[model samples]
Target chain A: MLEAREPMSAEAAEVSRPSRRGTLYRGDPGMWSWVAHRITGVLTFFFLFAHVLDTALVRVSPQAYNEIIETYKTPLVNLMEVGLVGAVLYHALNGVRVMLVDFWAKGPRYQKQMLWGILVVWLLVMVPGAYFMLVRTVTEMFGGS
Target chain B: MTLALDKPRTPRRPAARRNNWELASWVFMRVSGVALLVLVLGHLLIMNILDGGVHRINWGFVAGRWSSPFWQFWDLAMLWLAEIHGGNGLRTIINDYARKDATRFWLKVLLYVSMVLILALGTFVIFTFDPNFDA
Candidate 1:
C-alpha cells in the first residue's frame, strides 16, 4: 500500500528549498563565530558562578576548600581547563574583531580577514598554552623521569 | 490613477521612551571585552601556565595571592567586569531566542537574579577573605 505525505505550507516549502537565501545568516563564518561566542560566553558564566562558590569555601575551612579544589587537579578536569582556555581565548579574540567591525574606519571591509587572523593567533597561543597547562598532568601520569 | 502605498512598519517602542541604554550596552561590551582579554589572559597565565598549573592551587596558594592587595584588586576587578560582561551577553541571547513576552520576562528575571547573587557573593568573598583563617 502507498503511504500519503502531508502537504507542506509556504514557509516550510521555502525552508525545504535548497536556496542560499532561505536563512538570514545562512551559516556563514560570521554567524558561526557569533554562535561560538554565545556558547562560550554562557559556559564561562556558569563556570564563574561555580568558581566563586568554590572559592567561598575558604570561609568554611581550608580543608573544605582544598577538598573540592582537588577535583580540579585531576587529569580529566585538567583537560577541561585546557578546553576552557580555548573557549575564553576564542571569545576574547573574536570580541576584538567585533569591536573593530563596529568602530574602525575600514573594519567592516576586513571583518572576514580579521576573523581568519584571530583564528591564527588563537592557534599560536593555544598550542603552547595547552602544552604548559597539561605538562604536569602528562609528567605525573607517565612517571616523571 | 496613482497606486496606494503600503503603511510603514511600526516602531518597536515609542519615540518618547527612546534612550541610549542599548548604545551604552553595546559600547560597554566592547570596552569590557578588551579589558577582559588582558585581565583574563594574564590571570590564566599566572594561574594555569606558570610554575605548576592547578596542582599548585590550594588554600595556601590562594592565601598567598590574596595576601597582596594587588592580586586582591586584580581578582575583584576581574570578577565584577567578567560577570557584568557575561550577564549582558546572555541578556542579548535571551532577547534573540525567546519569542513570547512571558518567556522573555521570566528568563531575564532568572538571569538578573543569578547575576545579582553571583556579584554579591563574589564581592563579599573578596572583601572578607581571611588569609589567616586556618591559623
Candidate 2:
C-alpha cells in the first residue's frame, strides 16, 4: 500500500511551506536586552497614562486630586514607586544604547561593552535612588507612627 | 525519501516606497526617547525624591506648577512625546504578533482610539486648567 502512493508535486510543496517565526529569547544578550526594553517600555507607558489621568483629576476638583494623591503615600505604593523608578532607569539607559546602535559606526561591535556600561551606570544611579526612596518613605510612614 | 522539490512561488506585491513619514517616525523614536529620559527623570526626581517625595504632590503643587509656562510646557512635551513613543512601540508589537490582517487592523484601531483620547484629555487639562474653579 505504501509503494502505491504517488509523489507530491513541487508546486504543492512550495505552497505548503511554513513561515519562519523567530525564536523567543534563546539567551542572546541582544535578544534579552530588547525583551527587557519592550517590557520596561510598556510598564512605564501604562504608568504614565494613569498618572496623566490622575493629575488631570486636579482640574476636576482639588479635593479629589488631593485625596487620590494622599492614597499614594502608603508604604506599599512607595515601594511600587521604587519599581517604577527602576523601570524608567532601565528603559532610559537601554534606549541610549539603542540610539547608538542605530547611528554610531562602531556601535554594533561594542554593544556588549555598552551593555556592561549601562549596567554599571544603572547600579550607580539605582542604588542611591532605591536607598533614598525606601528609607524616606519607611521613615515617614513608621518613624513617627 | 521522496524526491519532490520546491518550486518558485509567485512574486509578492512590490515593496512600498519609503516616504517621509517612515523616516520621520524612525527619527522621532530616538529623539523622543532621549528627550523623555531627561524630562521624565527630572519629573521623577522632583515629584518622588525631593521635598518629602509623593507627599509633596498635592492640588496646590499641581496648581502652582501649571501656573508657570515653563512647567506647563515641560509637561506638555513629556506628555506628547511619551504617548507617541509608547503608541508607536505598541504598534510595532502588534504588527509583529498579530498575523491576521483583521486582528492587526482592530488592534491598531483600539490603540489609536486610546492614544487620541488620552492625548486630547491630557492637552485639554494642561491648557484649559482653571485652578480657580469653585469646588
Candidate 3:
C-alpha cells in the first residue's frame, strides 16, 4: 500500500500551504529574544524622550521645574521607574550580545550562552537597583505622610 | 569553486542603486548603541542613584550641571544619537509590520515628525537655557 501511494500534485501542495502563524511562535528562542529586544528598545526610547522634555523644563523656570520634579517623585512614577530600569537593563545587555554576534567569530554559535550570561548579569544588577529604587522611593514618599 | 558546465546559466541582473543607506544605518545602530550604553548608564547612575537620587534633582541641580560645557555636550550627544537610533529602529519595524503602503507611509511620517520635534525642542532647551532668568 505504501509503495502504491502517489506523490502530492502541485494543486494539492498549493491548497495545503503552511500558515505564517506557525513560524511566528514556533518556540524559537532567537525569535522571542529579538521581539523582546525590539519592545524594550522602543519603551526605553519613549521614556528617555519624556525624561528629556521634563528636564528641559528647568530652562523655562525654576518653579515649573520644581513642580514637575515633585510630581515625578510620586509613588506612581517611582513604581514605573522599576519598569524603566528593567527595560534599560535588558536593552543594554542584549545590545552587547548583538554586538558580539556581529563582531566575534564564535558569537553566533554561542548566542544561547551569551543570552543566558546577559540574563544573569541583568538580574545581578537589576535586583539591587530595583530594591533601592522601590524601597527608597516608597519610604521617602509615604513614610513622612 | 568554479561553476560546473552542467549548471544552467542565468541572466545577470543589472546592479541596483549605488546609495549605501542600508549599510550606513546598520553601522550607525552598532556605534550609536555602544555610545548610548555608556551615556545612558551614567545618566541613570547620576539621576536615579547617586546623591539622593531623583529627589535631589532640581532646577539648581540641572543649572549647575549645564553650567559646564562637558555636561552640555554629553547630554546633547545623548539626545541626538538616541533619537536617531530609535527613529531608525522604529522605521524598520513599521516597514516590517505595516502591510499596507498607505499605513507604512503615514506611520513613518508621524515618526519623523515626532522625532524632529523632540530633537529640535531638546537641542533648543539645552543651548538656550538661562539659569538666571527669573520666573
TM-score of each: 0.86, 0.84, 0.84
lDDT of 3: 0.79
Model 2 lDDT per residue over A13-78, tens place? 454323433634244466577788888888887887788888889888999998899878888888
Residue A124 deviation, candidate 1, in Å? Answer: 0.5
Q: Put down candidate 3 lDDT per residue, A1-145, tens digits, no spaces.
A: 0110112334333543357545543534555667788899889777867887888788778998999998877788877877887888888888888887777877666777788999999999888887766666767667755
Over B1-135, each residue of candidate 3 has an lDDT whose tens digit, in order, gives 354343344566455559878878888888998999999888887887666677788898888888899999999999999999989888888877899999999999999988998999999999999867766
Q: How does each model score on lDDT?
A: 0.83, 0.80, 0.79
Please list the Cα RMSD from the true structure of every candidate, rounded to 1 decimal place: 8.9, 10.6, 9.3
Position B132, candidate 3: lDDT: 74
DockQ of each: 0.39, 0.38, 0.38
TM-score for chain A, prediction 2: 0.77
Q: Per-residue lDDT tens digits of candidate 2, residues B13-110?
A: 55555767756777788888889989999998888877677877889888888889999999999999999999988887787789899999999999
C-alpha lDDT (0 to 100) for residue B104 of candidate 2? 96
Per-residue lDDT tens digits of candidate 1, residues B1-135? Answer: 365444467555334436778778877887788889889989988888888877899999999999999999999999989999999888888888899999999999999999999999988988998998944
Off by over 4 Å in 1: A1-26, B1-15
